[model samples]
Target: MTWTAPEPTRVGEPLTGPERPMLQGWLDWHRRTLLTKCAGLTADQLKLAAVEPSNLTLLGLVRHMTDVERVWFRWRAAGDHTVGSPYNSADNPDGDFDDVATADAEADLARFEAACADADRAAATLDLDHEFATARGRRSLRWVYLHMIEEYARHNGHADLLRERIDGVTGA
Candidate 1:
């Protein structure tokens, strides 16, 4: 049987909550929005570019976000600089977004999910005010949460357009 991206059960962001839960809720919502955009798409369709001269694809977005989750939450926020992107390297920095033509969409999606779960674990014991050093200087877990939500929200917008281009499906 042909593999297709599975639909994610997106939860509504909490209307009211503490700072951490509110941020986490929105981040999770955006993450699910990305997966929702890819639902029911076959590998080939997931690999389809948004348009010529642009390499964006649903599968590529999955891979890219997997790296983003790992980098910001697991690596930076959690202070595991040893963790590196699975789909990127100095020689091919854009691998996550550029290598989707033959990528396993199913596995990529699974990896994305795993990365998110790992990120959550990394942040679980930390305080929202927890701070870490980076080349850009110190950053707080709160900053990471805000940045991640913004990142996912921007990418999810691209995902919306890509999905629509692929199958004329639109909206959250």
Candidate 2:
């Protein structure tokens, strides 16, 4: 039997809430939205870069978002320098997107889920205004939250197109 990516239950972002919860809710919604786009796809289907010459695939989006979660939440926001890139390196910076042909789809999705959980924990105790220094200057937890949402939204768009091309399924 071929293995397919499991569907995720995505919650609707709260209509009205406090600042932190609102931001977190929207971020989580976007995260789940990405996974939803990959639901019910076999590993081979996910590995297909339906758009030629782009090298963009559903699995690659998952891998890229996994790294994004780790970098923004754990490394940057939580100030945990020990948390290194899980799927990329200076020698192969684009490994997450470029190296998915032979990748294990199930394991990669699991890793993305784990990264999201870790990211939540890392920022759990952080105040939205908490600031951290970066190579580009400084950023706050609020900024990270917003940036992550934007990141997921952009990638989820790609995921939507990829998934639709893989199969006729559509609707977010």
Candidate 3:
């Protein structure tokens, strides 16, 4: 039997909380928003491209975001150089989005969830002020949270369109 992506359990973003909790909550909400967009779609549907000349698909977005989480949190923020991105490389820079047609949607979704979990774990011990070097110079854990939130927000919008395109389902 083919694996199926499960519906995400989305929680309301905490309107009142500490700096860390609020950031984490908002990030989690956005993450779930992405998964929720993909939920209830079949593997073939998940792989359907938005239109001609565009490789953007729900599965591709999931795969791309999984690597984004791993890269920022596990690698850069936590300073773990050994942990490499699951998708993308020098030869296949667009693997995350370009290589989704034959990809396993369920496995990719699980990978996204696992990456998020690992990101949370990697960030748990760090202070918001903790800094890490990147190609754009040094940045802080606080910046990582804000950046991830922004990244997800942008992609979630694309996901919303992709989901609606796939089936007439709409609404957040």
Candidate 4:
């Protein structure tokens, strides 16, 4: 049997809830939104850029967001300073985007899922006001959550455009 990517299950963001649940709901919604945009795409299709001279792609976005989730949630927000991003280095800072032409879309998606799960575990015990040290100084867990939501929301837009360019599919 041929292997195919499973369809993404998108859950709507809560219109009314407590702050934590609401924030998490929105973040999860945006995360799934990105994957939904990539549904039914092949590996090459996942690597298709929106335009010339740009490294942006749905797979790249997924890998990049995986890095983002690991960095912010596990390392920064949870105060686990030992972890480092796999997609970045001094000499290869754009590895997530630049290296994605050869990315394994299914494995990349699994990496994203693991990152999100780790992020949730890391943040489970912390209150919204919990503080952690970063290069820019102290920041609250709330800030991290908000920043991640913004990150996914922004990248999901790029994913939308890439998806549309790939097959003319639109409307989230």
Candidate 5:
């Protein structure tokens, strides 16, 4: 079946489940929370390239997270965590950082939403205890979940500063 990408998320709290997750679910929650920080800005705002050749921006982070989602669950996981994608070639793949020029605010938000949806599905469907081979070799699905959460959280911090610099907003 063809998977049309998810639309950009609404600007608000994440749509949560009735009972909260133990660990994996919590990781998923944090990832969504991080993305919410960039929720309402325009593509030009989201793609605001840093001064003096720095490649950092909210749009770059969105693409990188999509790469991370694909890397961890789609490409790296084993057993219950079956990974997949909506796109075939990531093209230069390095475009995650270098291609910010192509970022349409709506498009970037759509990419982030799609990644979040796939990640939510994987976290729900996977066996947390399942082992996956990584560059670190034999990492459990739980580790991947937590690592991605941490990764997203760290990027969100960077995003917080970037967003503030783009406008005048502040606070986490």
Candidate 6:
């Protein structure tokens, strides 16, 4: 399925498609926005822990957001299809990045990218007005897409700081 969005990027710009405030437009914009937040960084820079007390690394955020996208869209929205086990286990809410070894960096990133791809594909085909029930109760796919946009937009702000602190680069 193809993306039906009208925007080129999620934030600070108009897009190159048929003009409309469609669901795909918002979701695609947000998707691009989230991915852009992670652009222009080395694997090491992405793993920076500059603030010590802060777990505010770009890589950490990627892993966490990937888990979030998976749970909300794939697991909950898709009605319990397996996309691997939940990243958050009984004793590990941060399991997404809990074992961030230098050796595993590539694999972890691949996982995140794959998750995003899966989400894009699902969203392209899934109905925006469809309802999905979860522990939080049923929600429209409209809610899910907007929620994802909110989730990534918020974290991308944090990513700007982490990236800037790492290398002084910033922007949407």
- For TM-score, the strongest prediction is 2
Per-residue lDDT for 50-87 in model 2, tens only? 98879999999999999999999999889898998767
The TM-score of predicted model 3 comes to 0.96
Ranking of models by TM-score: 2, 1, 3, 4, 6, 5
lDDT of 5 by residue, 73-101 (tens): 76676333445433334566467767777
**RMSD of candidate 3 to true structure, Å:** 1.2
Q: Candidate 3's C-alpha lDDT?
A: 0.91
* Lowest-sum lDDT 10-residue window in model 2: 78-87
TM-score of each: 0.97, 0.98, 0.96, 0.94, 0.74, 0.77
RMSD value for candidate 1 = 0.9
Please give the distance, in angstroms, between residue 78's alpha carbon in candidate 2 and its true position after superposition.
Answer: 1.0
After superposition, the stretches of candidate 3 with alpha carbons farther than 4 Å from their true spots are 1-3
For model 1, the local distance difference test gives 0.91
Q: Provide the lowest-lDDT 10-residue window in model 3.
A: 1-10
Clashing pairs in 3: none
Q: Measured by C-alpha RMSD in angstroms, how accurate is candidate 4?
A: 1.4
Off by over 4 Å in 4: 1-3
**Candidate 6 error regions (>4 Å):** 1-21, 85-87
**Looking at candidate 3, what is the lDDT of residue 58?**
90
lDDT per residue for candidate 4 within 3-88, as digits (tens), equals 35568888888999799999899988988888888788887888888766676888889889999999898888887888787677
Encode model 3's per-residue lDDT on 1-172: one tens digit a residue.
Answer: 6555688899998999799999999999999999999888889989999755777999999999999999999899999989876778999999999998788888889899999999999999899999988887999999999999999999999999998888977777
- In candidate 4, the residue pairs with backbone N, CA or C atoms under 3 Å apart (3 or more residues apart, or in different chains) clash, namely none
Error of 3 at 47 (Å): 0.5
Instruction: Give the runs in model 2 whose Cα sits over 4 Å from its true position.
Output: none
State the C-alpha lDDT per candidate: 0.91, 0.91, 0.91, 0.86, 0.65, 0.67
